[model samples]
Target chain A: MEGTNFQRYLARKKAMSAYTWNEVKKHKMLYLFLFPFLLIFATFTLAPVGISLGLSFTYFNVLEPPRWIGFTNYLNLFLSDDIFIIALRNTIILATITGPVGFMAAFLFAWFINELPRFIRAFVTLVFYAPTIAGSAYLVWLLIFSGDSMGHLNAYLMRAGIINSPILWLTNPDYMMYVIIIVVLWMSLGAGFLAFIAGLSTIDEALYEAGLVDGVRNRWQELWFITLPNMQGMLLFGAVMAITSSFAVGEVTQNLAGFPSTDYEVHTIVNHLVDYGAMRFEMGYASAIATILFISMIYAKRIVSSFIGKIGR
Target chain B: MIGAAKKDKTSASGRRIVKVSRAVRKPNRSLGGDIFIWGILIIFGIFFIFPLVFNINQAFKPLNEIFIFPPNLFVINPTTDNISDLFIIMSRSWVTFTRYIFNTVFITFVGTAGHLFVASLGAFAVSKYDFPGSKFFFGIIITALMFNQYVTAIPNFLILTQLGWIDTYWAVIIPAFGMPLGFFLMKQFMDTIPVSLVEAAKIDGASEWLIYWRIVLPLVKPALLTVMVFAVQALWNNPQSLVIHTEQLKTLPLAISQIIGSPHAPQVARAGVNAAGLMVLMMVPIIIFVTAQSNILKTMASSGIKE
Candidate 1:
């Protein structure tokens, strides 16, 4: 009986391999098309994450060969590196504030502007999108939040008797994160915003009429019942964009708050990673930091995705 | 038979309940609601456009106007001096100003084209055909969008070092071709194209490559254009700080920021020049976007992330 079962298993395995090979031959052209992207993606993106994860378990500083030090880098990160905790806390705080708020703002703004005339719609889209695409637009913010009276916000506030002196907005720990959040929110209406706009437009108009017949009383109800359900896919996409942007909040903080801002107030995991990886050349430690960030981002995505699944149900 | 009977009974009751509760609800565009929405939009619009307007105005402003105490939002005595000064500053750099422009243009063109071609081909195969690992490949692509460059930068650097691609334009361009978002989006858009259309071409003895290149591509022009906008925006704005180190190979944004003396430096004298440089940096991508705006919207209409 055992010999017969073993023979059956071998036959099944052989059949599966034959089936797969036939499929491969049948779709040979498809594989040919997919080869370039797969090669590049595996080499650049997939292998890097795997390599980074492996490197996180070691102690390497680039000049010397990586020495195995399993869990030491991670242990040091959790216990000894006080800055990592602050960075973790700050990243979570930043992501929490900006992610959902930015997502909602993008969706609401896109929906609102969708009802406008075509020309006006395009113009409004440009207005919302310009700050993000503008490579050095952060310079405008630097001037606006400049530490002196010459700064626009300070000048206005002082003239209005709101404050007596310039607030040193960027460098001040109390206000730095807030400034970063505001800038983040400003630029958040990006590709996701455009996607929402397109998604909103694509909803079949006939559905609204059908919805009215089914007792959808007002625009709000119509939206909840029809629009939300129809655009859940776009919402999911937008949520991913929002989560990624909000979590990877590094450059804005650095650009505005002058790298390693006062008290490490606005220090994020990415900033810490850069400090170790680029500045300090602690590749192992930086890889651990990156691993932590990657895990948290995936966690956030999973939560958001499941939550989106329940929308308008 | 029993299950069918039960389903009928429940559906009948459901219909009755819906009918009983149904009201004569007008699809009304209330005046108050319109005003409220428009009011909010106008406020947000101002918030959005304020910086761009300020940047543009500052670029055209004379040195005196740039330093005005209140920082006038509008320029009274606009001059080409700031723009000319930006040119002068660029010319004085170790690398010629045109070299920077050429570098950016070359990188942007090659990167955008490579990404679009590679991503579209991958997207087409995955979307149109039922290959063994197609679903798994696409699943990875979706998950890939969850992290940004910060998480991948170090490992990417290591990989580039291994390939001996560091300090070359290939360092920037090749990696960009692997950006999964474009693949994800193009697949979403491609999925909307009917399979019958491809099969029809196939029945006529058209090769898969010919069908994809000649027929499938033209049909997905909006997606093509949308992806182009995204690719252009990314490559055009890329500072390429991680890989490329040669001054001659550096792009426009790096050069502009260098000339403008880092935003951290409180140089009052360089304010107008900074604005002019920023204006130049910001406008190219925006112009490209404006031209492709309609097509992008059409493409994105089909860009829903399906489970």
Candidate 2:
């Protein structure tokens, strides 16, 4: 039966060539609409991704020819580079702490704020979202944590006699991770937060009424019964975004804590990739780092999607 | 048969009891819950506003106030000298201040408008059409979303150089058409449009283009507006975009970062100047946020529910 089915599929394919051409002709308008995007994407995005993968297998520094040295790059990254290992560990830790925490905070804030009467809710949303929108928002945190007597946080701490001297907030490795994490969380209430608010509104009011009628006692119960089940799709989207951003979190560290952070305490995989790619001209090694980062994000997305798939089931 | 009949009867009876009781009750909206919600709202409000307020306040602070023994959170004596000097500082450079603004606006408008059409067209094709390999195309988009864009930056730059697009607006503007987020969001939103509407148009002899433009595009207006907001944000905030290398074409954010990052951007006025730049950098986005505020919220409400 299987052999016959395979034979039939092959026969259909051979017969369908002219017929498929007609179908393709019928859909020419869609193809036309799709052309510009595909053209640019093929040239820039798809081609570059392929290039990065190709480069990952070779030893290339722009001035020299790309020497094919497959798997050695990967092997070196795993075993020889202690810095990559530290970066991997730090990235995992940061993701675990902030990813889920920020996700929940975003949802909770959006949900509660949504319950407010109209105008005030908009005002509040703007307030919460402003920091993320402010392009140099992180610069403000840098100022607050500046290792100067005049820094606001330091001035307050000194005035209150909490410490003897102005602390090196960004420089000190002991406080670096915490400071970066806090600042990240503060700025994390961005598009995803707005997404949750929007997602909440899409849920029908009739569902809530029906849920209460079925003996739902309070807001929490209604949320568990009706809201979560209804917005599973949005939740999944938010979770994927949250996980991606969480893993891709070296920028704040690069900005706040110096890049080769004191003993590389705050280094992330992206920073390690940049260290090779940008600072050094080892394009092949950087590509290898990027490949690993790419693979990890895909893996993270898979795990997150599967987990979200189980929500409200 | 008897046992099955008895089970069905009991379950039906139970369902009736639920329905009858459900008919008696109304949805609760307690004042106490409202009060508690407001309390939490106020706390998060303060937490969110402090950094923004401080940054804005710095725009008006004197250099003395900026570096005082105990730095003032609120400006005691506000001044416009810094704002005037920000212009003076830019005038000293090869690119004038207004030129940066023009470059930024031009790039942002062209890039954003291009993305709006190109992305939506791609999205419309995927969501509404049953063309061969459509699934594969969309799958590639999903995969693209997972990967960090920076990983591709080097190779993309190399590609641009090969095409002789280096130091050109085409290098920047063309790639904006392919942003995965805009495509993803628009496609998801378009998916919700009813097939019957398209079918009805087709029955009335509407061309595919007409059906798309008149029937489908208008339905996803909220999504389009939201994408516009995002496109503006992405183009405006980036001081680090690699494409624009020519001094004549430097955007506002790049010039602003230069002003802030320079060691000798007039020392006494550096803080004030930096603050003024920060304000300018954030101003347009803030205005957009305020103006399209509802549309943004509406888009968010509809988004993130689909894979």
Candidate 3:
């Protein structure tokens, strides 16, 4: 009986190996086409992700060998790092402020465009979207808040007698966060606006007429019953896009606010990560912060998706 | 046909009556809303376009004129001296501006082509083929879409370092070749293509590659163009990525950043140069978009996909 079982196991193993070889032979061309893509994807996308996950457990500098420090980095980040705490608070603040406001703006713009004549809509959309293709949209904000009396906004305000003195828009600790938020809202308006406009276009006009017949008396009722329901998936997708963008607010924060905010008011988690990980070479600690960020985003995404799913159904 | 024409005439007159009633409700008060709408839109438009206008205005002014009180709103007397000076600086600088443009064009073109090819192939496979793990792969791609570039920054840097691909075109082009977002767009677009065509092509002795290259590609040209526009914008504006590459192999965006950092950079001239750089960067995409606006919008509408 033992000899028979051993022979059966050997036969099964041989069959499994043969099956694998057959897969390779049958899909050889497919494999060949996919090879280069897989290599690059693994190298750039998958490998980096794996390494970051691993590094979240180790203490390393680019200059020295990584030490397996386990979860000490995470423990220290949670308990000890005051800056990390500030970054988390500030990033949440910025995201909360921008996400809803930006979404509403995009929605309103899209709705308005949908109501306009075709040529007018096309021209206006182009005008609104043109700034995105140009790299200096943020630079435009920089000029407006140039920190000097000569700054365009300050100049206009002073000329109009709104204030006797120029406000230090970029330098003030209290107002700097607002300034960054405004710039982000302005720059991000284009993409979200485009998405909303696309969503609005997908909504069937018959649904609105049907709502009217069903006693949807006003614009609000029509929107709630017809437009919103019809465009639920797009709306959810837009929300996800907005959330991702709000969390990943790096370039504007870095460019406008610099390293730390004037009073540690506007420094986001991403900025902190760059400071510690890239500049200071604290790989383990930065990884911990990043991992926390990742987990929070995942959690937030779950909440958002659930809310959207409820509305959609 | 007579009944349809009669119904259309009645509806047209009904619309006119509705407009007249709306106008009569409160002429001044109703005008207020119209004014308010235009007012807000105009303010926002100015807000958006003012910087580019300001930059262009500043570029034509002399260095001393840049810091004038009230900030010169427009150029009264423009000169070619700034342009001449810009050329002289470009000629003297070790960094070749022309080469930088070439590098940018090459990277954008190759990366766009690579993305179009691979993304279309991958999209076609997922959209058309029924295979084990296809759904799983699709889910993985969606999850990967949520992974921001910043999250992958350090690890990608390390990987690039390991592969000794730093400062090479491969570092930029290869990594960008398989964008999951582009793949998603393509798949969504291709799904709209009828399945009958694929079977017909197969019956006619066309291989999958031939079908993809011939039928599928031509049918999805508008999507491909839209994706191409997105790819160009991303590559063109990508200074942060290029900074990780070698200094000498810098693209135009990185070059602008470098010029910004230089000590001898003139304030007024810098604005102009940035304006010029922006104008140059935007020109191609804008022209492509404008010329293909109807086609792109129609395609986007049909596919029901958003970036």
DockQ of 2: 0.39
Candidate No. with top DockQ:
1
Model 1 docking category: acceptable
**Candidate 1 C-alpha lDDT tens digits along A1-313:** 9999999999999999999999999999899999999999988888888989999999999999999999999999999999999999999999999999999999988987876666688888888888878766766888788888878999999999999989989888879888989988887776789899999998998998898678664566667789999998899999989988999988888888988889999999999999999999999999999999999999999999899999889
Q: What is the Å distance of residue A277 in model 3 from its true position?
A: 2.0
**The 10-residue segment with the lowest total lDDT in model 3 chain A:** A215-224
What TM-score does each of the candidates earn? 0.93, 0.91, 0.85
DockQ of each candidate relative to the true complex: 0.44, 0.39, 0.28
lDDT of 2 by residue, A111-167 (tens): 888787766888888888887787666677877888778778988999999998989
Against the true structure, whose lDDT is highest?
1
Interface RMSD of 1: 5.5
Q: Report clashes for each candidate as comma-separated counts.
A: 0, 6, 0
The lowest-lDDT stretch of 10 consecutive residues in candidate 2 chain B is B1-10
Candidate ranking under lDDT, highest first, comes to 1, 2, 3
The chain A TM-scores for the candidates, taken one by one, are 0.95, 0.93, 0.85
Model 3's CAPRI class is acceptable
What ranges in model 1 sit over 4 Å off?
A1-14, B1-26
Which number leads on TM-score?
1
Off by over 4 Å in 2: A1-22, B1-35, B262-269, B305-307
Candidate 3, backbone clash total: 0
Query: Residue A258 in model 3: shift from native, Å?
Result: 2.3
